[model samples]
Target: MSSLFGILSAAGQSLLTFQRGINSTNKNIANVSTEGYNREIPVFQDLPRSGVFMNKIIRVFDQSLFSRSIDLNQKLNSDNEFASGLSNIETIFNDALGTGFSSDLNTFFNSINDMLIKPDDLAARSQFLANAQTLVGKIRNTDKALEDLKQQTVLKVRDQINQINQITSQLAKLNQSIKTKTLDIEVNNEYLNERDRLIKQLSDLIDTKVVFNEDNTVNVFTAKGYGLVVGIESTQLSFETDSNGNAVVKWNNVADITKEIQNGQVGGNLKTIDKVNEQLNKLNDFVTVLTTVFNKVHRQGYGLDGSTNTDFFTIDPSKSGTKIDASNVYINITDPKKVALASDPKYLNSDNTNGKNLLGLKNNISNLYTNPSQPVLTPTEEANLKASLNDPTNYDFIKTHTFAEFYNTKLVAEVSSTSSYIKQQQQNNKYLYDAITEKMKSITGVNMDEELINLTKLQRSYEASARIITVTDELMQTILGLIK
Candidate 1:
């Protein structure tokens, strides 16, 4: 009877252990579609001279794989953000769909070429003035678009920082709750899953470095070593507007971290804004050269009204400080008769010398993209241009490249090339991110078929343990009956 009782006790413990195994398998199958969930496994230990019993449940996770996935996640977000912002800027300059600055520039100059046929034709002069206004409108509109884009990008960063704060706050709370996880009877999986999910969410907004703690909580920091979370507490990031009305990212509302954010969405946006400002400066330079050359040549010619030395293009240099830019550059001449067509006032309507010489200027300074260096101006033609080009000190770029070619070669080409490179990197990192995630999933994600098989085995083992307990009870009853 004593032996039967011992057998019964061991069989009962075995039954409980098999039941625990089935519970773990079921838990995995139930959470198969859950994001950030790890499959749980039942660990059993055999007692001395007794049956096996489950000790605890452990989640299937690989530390190395998890850490690598976080890194790829931030990098992929950085490139994706850059690509998105760059597309907006590219669209502003791209004229494939409509007439942008480049197109208007060609039309403005081509209109001048048309006027050469009949210098005194008021209809031709009127069309030339109209084209000039269109060209100026394009430059001003482009400047406004670039300004709007930068402001919009700054707003976007502000929103992302707010999102980062929300994630950090949740992460701190998860840390406190998950401290009791993975150790005792409270083997809570949701706390750990939510913690990891928050970490990935934070990574998308900015670069993060995660440190796993022994208590099943995590400590996170920026790649630049700014701490975001310590133990169960999280730090909040904020921003301030500088005197120039630029957004400056602040850490803990005290220290400026604008330069420290070298990855993720915030970093991408900052870089994009920097590029916009750089192009803006280059545009200003191109405008200075353009206004100088066009105004000077126009002043040297005479209009139908015998107007000379009048600026064809004007800019408020006082507001612009050092030089004219797209912001202030505009047509000074509204009257079609003010369109200077004669190089000399004496040859106003018949000679066409002044207008012809103006046409020679465009040909001399050939558009790098459209044509190569034109044959050098004849000595007589060079003499005629010298009257207007006397101030060689003012025009530097126009000596070699046309207005359109200068902007296209310097500014547009740079943006396009940089954008293409970033897009490629974004694509490549996406593939890498997916690969790392899949690898991590292989170890941590539940396999439906595998779980079902394990469930079946657990069921069989549970039944066998029940049968043993029954048999031991029956044997004990027989012995008891004999003794009685």
Candidate 2:
């Protein structure tokens, strides 16, 4: 019961609807190689009577796949950052390269052996002081390297926070644009894609959570529930120096979240900073042990000049602090004749008892060099290994395990083990991230051949609908001719 004009109207509307489908197909073909682009499908709904109309779009995406991808990306970044920091620390302790504290320590102790053999040799005493200076330089350099690494990591934390804030701010803008244009399918689709891209980028800097809203807006939060983006407003993260001069991450520039972050670049930086501080603390303890017992013994002995009660180790006068920090402790005796090598005034120049005693201290401190075949510590020994760190004067424990053992087993080995673990974790995370990415691509990636076929079908439909319109117009013309 429809008129000819009604037929023309349906055909005309169908042409536009089919054209929309064609445009979408062409777009899919055009963007086939675009990264992070999710191909879209234009859904057409049948009209109540006899026509079809273009409806909403169904973006090809799986939320679960996207979430997993972000998770793995953040984890991989964390491992990468940790590995980079540890690499620098490993270089500091590379003894095989002849640049570490081991050789200097050996030379210093060998000088003591020379003095014990020839008590009248002032050359032996001078060589000992020279070797001691070299050892002190090595320790100072190691401490400076660790401190530098920590400062660099702290800067990384601050930089990551800034990056996170920038991403969240951009996300907030996208949310506003998306909410305003929710009804505009084309514009909103692009906005959603951009939002997803930004979210993935944010995950690289910090661990975050993304929630999709009913109105197509997204809200972002930290893993610990700190709001980053909500509706159209974004809360930013900031960094400040705490009382200890360590950088602390904060929410709204107030509440500290430095320890709260556990993954991504920020988490890795925080964790590496802790490790640097640990090494510094251990190095300080080692210095305390070196200066404490060496000075105690040297001060009790007598030099050729009958010098008595002369301290062997003191802070560099040029330095401002009194603490015997690793970086500040130096050789205080420059005069070879001032070297204390006698236990008695009766035989000050002839007897080498004090020289022999000093050699004994050196032997115990570097025991691993002379006895490398010592068995791995028992449980009791392992428990006592760290006791010297609290009280470095515990010569009972120090003598057995030796300073060389503590440095190698505890310091060097810790870096090596952590590096190995992180390398493995980085490899595992890459595998998992790749697997998830492949799945996501299969589901959302554009298929050029499929899109071409769809384009052909849409073109044919559009042509047929145009033909109907042409035929109906001719029929109307003929009816007008009859009326004339």
Candidate 3:
């Protein structure tokens, strides 16, 4: 009778075990399509029976394997995030290649070269001025585009921070739930699934390290050592513009978090914006120098037909901001008919038959277009030029001899090199992104066929266990009838 009772108890335990197995199978099937869901299994163990017989059934997760899986999933998410960021950065600069400011600048310089062949022609000069205006317009447009990109980057950072906060909050709530709930294997499995999903989400925002605490809670931190989530609370992040108009990102209103937020979308976007700003600054300086030098040369020359008091160009000194405004300057030679040596009184006694000064002025203007010297006026030179223009002491020499050729060459070369470097960086980013994305897909992406197979197998195991329980019940009924 005791042996029979032991058999009955073993059968009863098997029936319960079968029911839990069926539930686990159903759960796996239901969540098969869910993103970030890991397939779960019920682990079984035999209880030591009295007098050399096994009694109860024990089912739990393989904790070592589950923990390792979680770690791998987090790594996969981080790599995917970094790849996505790099891809976006590549797209921005790749599109910048054909229809960008660099192309526009090349066209504008070519137009200037075209105008130089006919320096005396008023229509040609007008075309040159128009191209110059267009060039400045392109610079302004490009600078604005860069500023827009910077603003977009700031917004992206804010969005990511918001997402991080939401995930962390969810994690904190899960921590509380897990601690309060009873540790039935079935219930713990559900909590673990939710925890894994939140962890993956957090991983995508930034690379992180996960710590499993004693009470089944997770502690998350950046790879660079900034806390994300701890027990029942999360550190909050915020972004704002500083007094200097630079974007600042902070955490907990105490710690500086920017450096720790590395290699993600926010970091990639910030890097791109910084590069654009640097390029814009270089271009602005180029334009400012061009305008300054051209005005210096134009102010010294007498008007066509040589009027001593007349100026060929008028430029506003205040237009020398970080941005170039072409409206501040005007080339006043409108009439082609008035462009001869005798148009002004200064040319009346000025070697009209030889036309030396007039020829020199035309040559100097042509040289400006062709040679393009840098505006290298030192403080002393600028002061002398200003004094000479104000008081008229050898105005011709100051105008022609004051320009520096080497300085202009160096500036042009620098701008050209910078543009090239930016292009190269964009290309390299594309290659790196593609490679990393392919690697992540291999590891983290779902295999539908494998999941279907597992589902069918678990379903069969559950049904077999149910059949065993039904057989045991029938056997017990027969025994009771015999006893009666």
Best by TM-score: 2
**Model 2 RMSD in angstroms:** 4.7
C-alpha RMSD (angstroms) for model 3: 8.3
Candidate 2 residue 208 C-alpha distance from true site, Å: 1.8
| TM-score of each candidate structure, all chains considered together | 0.86, 0.89, 0.66
lDDT of 2 by residue, 1-484 (tens): 2588788888888999999899888888888998888999989988864477998778887988998999999898888888888888888889997546876777787888888777778888788888888899999998888888888888888888888989999999999898888566877788888988999999888888888898878899888999999999999898987664577988997778888887888888887887787778777777766676577667767888888788788998888664677868878888888788887877778777666656666646432222345322334643454464644443344556777776786678888999999889899998999999999988999988889888999999999999999999999999989999
Q: What does the lDDT come to for candidate 2?
A: 0.81
Candidate 2 deviant stretches above 4 angstroms: 48-50, 363-399, 474-484
Candidate 3 lDDT score relative to the true structure: 0.52
Better of 1 and 2 by lDDT: 2
Candidate 3 lDDT over 133-204, as tens digits, reads 565555555555556656776677678778888988899889888878664656765687688778766765
lDDT of 2 at 65: 90
Q: Where does candidate 3 stray beyond 4 Å? A: 1-6, 48-98, 101-120, 305-376, 379-484
Instruction: Tally clashes: model 2.
Output: 0
In order, what lDDT does every prediction score? 0.78, 0.81, 0.52
